[model samples]
Target: MKSKSIGLSPKSFYYGYDSKKDLKHLVRLVLILVFIALLTGMIGIWVVYRSAHERHLDMLRAFANTQGDVLDAYMLLDEVKSGRVHGDTPHEHNLDNVKELLLKQESFLETGQLLLAYEDTSTGKYILIGTGHMPSGQHSVLVVENTRELTPSMRLALEGKEGVLEGQDLHGAPVVTAYLPISKHNAGLVVMLNQSEFYAPYHRARLITLGIGVVFVVFGTWVIWSAEQKNLRQVREREQLIRLSFENSAIGKALVAPDGSWLRANKSLVNILGYTEDELLRMDFQSITYPEDLEADLDHVQAMLKGEINVYHMDKRYFHKSGDIIWSHLSVSLVRDEQGEPKFFISQIQDITERKRVEFENQRLHERLMDQLSLRRQQLDTASGALEGFAYSVSHDLRAPLRAMSGFSQALQEEYGDKLDDTASDYIRRIHRASTNMAELIDSILRLSRTSFGELNVVSLDITAMSKRVVENCRVVEPDYPVEVRVAPGLKGQGDLRLIGSVLDNLIGNAWKYTHGVENPLIEVGQEHVTLSEQSDDSVLAFYVRDNGVGFDMAYSNKLFRPFQRIHSDREFEGSGVGLASAQTIINRHGGQIWAQGQTGKGATFYFTLNHTQFDSEKNSTS
Candidate 1:
């Protein structure tokens, strides 16, 4: 039994409904297939064109090689005729015969001209000896006695290598060339074909392939259009959705007219500026921009309009509706119409007021920190001056008593040496030695203080000459001590002359002292390449003094630069243990580092840098 209809009849309900959604899916599938077909066609075109171009290049290379072989044979024959071996230079008459053969062979070549050139080893010039074609109407070959710039292929041939290169010929026309050297004659043969003619066939084939691809694309587009026309109502629905998305975007987006007037703005933009849509629509960007920032913003906008730049981003300030300033990062891009004329600008903005506030606070803190640093620097200067004064006082007031003790002890030894007992004489000698050691310690302290306090006098110094003079002084001071010193020549650096001289004296003296009692004592000074922690390149100069003398254990290397830290006893080394320490202090003042490497009873090498710019106190001296 038929039931009573609850709503409209079935035919009425289904009327005017054609399921256009399914139609859209079908159209999309068709379009995709068409695109694949078009892509395949285009790829085929590229493969054909590339294959043809390579084939032509290979043919040219083969022809060039054959011609080169013939030319080499002719050159060899000429050399033999001139009563010379294969490698000897050919005579003028032999060169003339080779030139005639080259000119004769040029007619047989299908698409290229030939040239013979020899490189003048003395002048580094490629001198043309022969050419198949003469200069006419800008189509020319290099002439005899005229120079030609060497191409990569030509340069390789000059070095007795064969190669091919694509480059510009002498007439500045693009060409592909093959170069082969005539080994015995010290010359080369070059075959050049115009690139335009070489690629003409390939270009024609590429055009045909592209034409087929275009036809397929056009037909696919027609099918898509016809199918799309049947879905007008669905298209309208999509348009509404797009509009809604534009209005509800989270980012502040706007379309501004070329005249800087707001054409459309999203809800996010309205919320950012605290302005209603109606209010914003009536205002232009220039009206709300902070006065100081408007000029720069306008300059970028004009530049975009003139095509100097495509897009720009700037941090800008705008007046809010409530009269407060709002900071934002504004990114703008110019949009053009189909005719390529200025249409409008698409702008995206993000609020940056919080970031700006943090930046301002950081700047304030930085200024405060700089002020504190300046105040501390002044205090340090005052303290350093006080210390310098104290050192000077110690130098004068402390040395006077030590001198008296030394003088009295020496007087007793000389005046009463025979009368005094042996024990008494021994006590007197002990006092004299103690006084001398104390005097040496005092001198080292004063020198260390001076090096730390004085300003550096930097200049270009001849280090080798300075080292030689220091060695000379050492020789005169200790004539009996047999020592051999070798100073490397041409060693120069930028440093203070007097201070660096002191550094050399101390180092050389230590080397001379330590090498005592050894057979054939030797010292050598030279420079080496060094790498610093902060620099990636190993270009730092490490000037070193090496000696074959009695060396200390590596375990004590850390204490080598500390004052009063001695590896050997006073009787063994006869030093106050302050010589190396003083040397280190001088090097440090010159913005340099000093390090030592040694093995027990073997030898020692002291390496240092003169232009180091960093000083870490932790690494400067040993505990």
Candidate 2:
């Protein structure tokens, strides 16, 4: 029986991994190597071509020099023949001297031939009429006369005047012949020699060298390509791994260069921006960001450069390739160079377009609700003003009738008591009492009317001074009433003086009224500046009035401003219950807030806020 495998078995598993063979790849690698070899071979061919041409040129220069020298010698020969040269002439002649010079330069001649030619001025033709020998090298030499004779460079003893000739000789060997004209005794003579045949063998040797170089260079390039194939195979393998990771990552990714050039972008970033990678990369951040968004983006990037932020997260817009806007919540990190300068940025993007749409919709709904509430409040204000007017009219008009009724009833009781019974008198007294209550109700309504239509003297008022004044007036109204006032100095704010005065009057007066029956009325007025934000970027100055008075429950705080929505009954406290409400309205009209905090019988503290938002800004900058 075979042994049951507990885990991976030694028999079935290899010690390590092995490379799977790719036959096509091997062949491709070889081909690429060969191609590189071919490229190198091309370089070698160029070098050989250059060298061969140079060698051929060198041979020509050398041949030309030799020809120049030989021509010199031949001219001397003609001078000797004409007796212009100092030499033993007729016996040791010009031709003999020319032969000796040719033999000295024979080593450079190779197997090529040298010939002599001179112009026959009489015939206007060149004739090669002499021959000379040279030592052996790669080329052999021979002499020939021209079959197609033309030009006069072939007179024997012309040695002193310059004459030039070029063409193939009769044997079809290329030659350049020169003559130096000689004038002795009114007879002309020239010496001429051949040169180019000496260069042919060197030219053939150079062609052979170039051909060999082409073969070796081609072979060398193939080897270099073979090496590159190994490297390419490794690159392809690594690319596969990179592709797998890039396609599967959760975050949208992009690699951006310092100049806003895109190096790479993953699929996720493309989806987020509603663009293909190619399209997104074609643009920079400025091209897609909303105009409003650009400033904030610039601010953040500036902060990052200043070391204020390490990584920045922002919601921005990118216009899509399809002409739609895509909202992205991006987190960017600055990738830096070794010297700590920013090289590029790596961005990870999240699609937040859906969330942004919802947020925008919610904001619109909220604005609509606020608008509706404001409209309703305006209507309520109008109705409240109208009611105050009605009450004021009723209060002033009804007062005279109520006083007359009281007088008439009293007079009847005094003049006709005998006619009327006790019950009749009691009924008249009850009527009088009812009219008195009505008169008081009208008086209270009139007070509210005054508050609604009150005149305002807007100014910069000191609250500390105003609070003290209110307290002093309260003391005068009740000389024996016990009241205490503590007001902080320099508590100045901007508002209508009368309205603020009314606010102080109503609040302080309520403090006086509700502290009625107390052993001592305690009132404290003070000011304090409090920061609304932790950074104190904005702060407000608040004024508070505290009183040991009848205070309402906390649950009914919202109703505190509604007229007559009193927690205490009228029988317990004779009030229109509109004082605090009126105070609030005045404060609100001045663009401030009034709030009350208290417990029943403990006391109430009324606080109000005046927006010195302007002052706050100035103060923060100074601090």
Candidate 3:
């Protein structure tokens, strides 16, 4: 005969046809659990209720203190109206007014007394008007709601000695009390309270706890019994089942020697090492585990033994019966004895070789895809370089001959005017002007196309000095205006220098042109650090060329950066409408962006950002 334990818990195991023992054990376990839970819950309930009542008592105390001050005013009135009225002093006019005020606040005094605990020793009326003379050379105060209960210690208080005493009042209450003696002007006050009120909540709490404890035991037993029946549902009652439950339970069900030898394992665990059930029972977990995984598993098992982590899952390779490596997801837990120290290891294993293979394939594919993407980007940059070469040739070579043709045609008209009629002369002048304009248009397009290229020589360039040079060129173009220029220092930026310089030329030149209408114009070139969004992680310097000049309408700001887009006519401000487009292309080439803001009659400011990585690269390249 074999004996084993069984309850609702997996921690329990049934042995050798003892259904009666199994059911009994289950009932006992649930009862114990329910009892513990009831104990904790009842204690919590008691604390919460006690805290609530304590707060109520505090509110009571605060109300009493507030009321005492109100009653004190009435006492002051009494002192004034009845001031030493022993055939000596008359009631003053101020005293009469105070007496009236006291009558006015009588209702408030009545409501106040309702919250306080008191007994008047003078007349045995707890709320009657009583007297206490202020020891500060003032008349005696009329006291209300004063305690009158005199214990053995306090009854003697009127007889002239002062001491703390505990005794029953006229109401037969066992109370704690205090007495203050007043020999002068024949007056005294007694303070008392029944001690039972403070302990009432605690006594009620204990009673509730006892009731819950009994109920818990009964309910817990029923739950545990039901749970046991549910567990037995899949267990077919047969001789083999009775044997197999003890022999082949899934969690490495085993009985082992003190030396850690295996005594048993289930069919599920037998497959873990590609061995038969009989073959595995002779081998411990350490015998099959690879040397590399053995130490880690043992350390984890030690931690489980010390109750650090209750259960641990590990992926480890083990030598099977045929010396083949088999990967398993091993879960080790303790099989405890009656005294609860670990007696044997119950190691659960799940073969996961297929899953590992899939993961390795996915990781390799990801690396391949990343390499392909990088190669594709390099190819695209190379292609964009070839396009830039074609554009530069088209702009420089094609436009040079066009400019010469425009100059010769204009010279032919001026030098050979007598050889032509009015219609022919006008036609030649128009042809020359058209050719010059086309040359300017081609120049603008080439500038825009070159900036659009992907190949960029990014570096930190002094934008302050760059702006000053652009202003100097603007001055050479328009020396009559005598325009002012202000460039910010510490205004270095990260970008392709040639492209960024083109952007400054367009922006600062636009500012200078717009301000030409002003008799004395002011142009400001400045940069300030800023964040585009209030909560954005990106931070950058906001560089702007602002001018005190004629500005465009607010509505047309969106068209400013668009290619071949213009807000003003060529006649008003002679431009190809491609300057802003060229500027945007340059900024975009350096991984930055440009935008303009202006109001009707207010100056325009252009702002943009470069990446922090670009700034660091610029610093390194310069050094």
Provide the RMSD of all predictions against the true structure, rounded to 1 decimal: 42.7, 17.7, 35.0
lDDT of 2 by residue, 1-623 (tens): 11122122222112122233344655566667666756776677668767864665455545544665655656665785687665533322453454455445443334234444444344544433333332223222323243234224433224434544554444455555444433422122222234445335446655775577556655654664566557566765666556556655677877655444554567887776676776765667667777778888778777776668899999988777676787889887776666886655677777788899999989888989899989987987788777876776687678888889988988888899789988999998998888887776676566656666655556898888898899888888788876767777787888888778888988888877888876677888886554555875565556888888877788888888777788877787767777877788777777677887888878888888765563466468657
Clash pairs for candidate 3: 119-146, 119-147, 119-148, 121-148, 130-143, 133-140
| Per-structure clash totals for the candidates | 0, 38, 6
TM-score of each: 0.51, 0.41, 0.45
In terms of lDDT, the best-performing candidate is: 1
lDDT of 1 by residue, 1-623 (tens): 11112222322221323446656776787778877986887787778777876777777767768877877777677777766654434444565677666655534344467767775555555556434344542223354442336556666676787767898775577878877877766777677777777777767777876787678777777777676665655755665576667678887888777778776777999999988776776778899998988999999999998999999999999998888898999999987766887767889988888899899889889888888888888888878898888888878888999899999988888998889999999999899988888888888788877877777899898989999998899889888777888999998877888889988988888888889878899999987754555556434568889899998899999999998899988878877777788788878777788888899888899988776542232225421
1 against 2, candidate with superior lDDT:
1
What lDDT tens digits, residue by residue, belong to model 3 across residues 315-414?
8888888897877787766766678766566666677667766776887888788788778877766776766777778887988888788888888888
* Span of ten consecutive residues with least summed lDDT in model 1: 1-10
Off by over 4 Å in 1: 1-250, 257-261, 298-312, 321-324, 333-344, 372-376, 400-437, 457-462, 490-494, 527-541, 589-592, 611-623
Candidate 2 Cα outliers beyond 4 Å, as residue runs:
1-426, 449-458, 528-542, 548-574, 588-604, 610-623
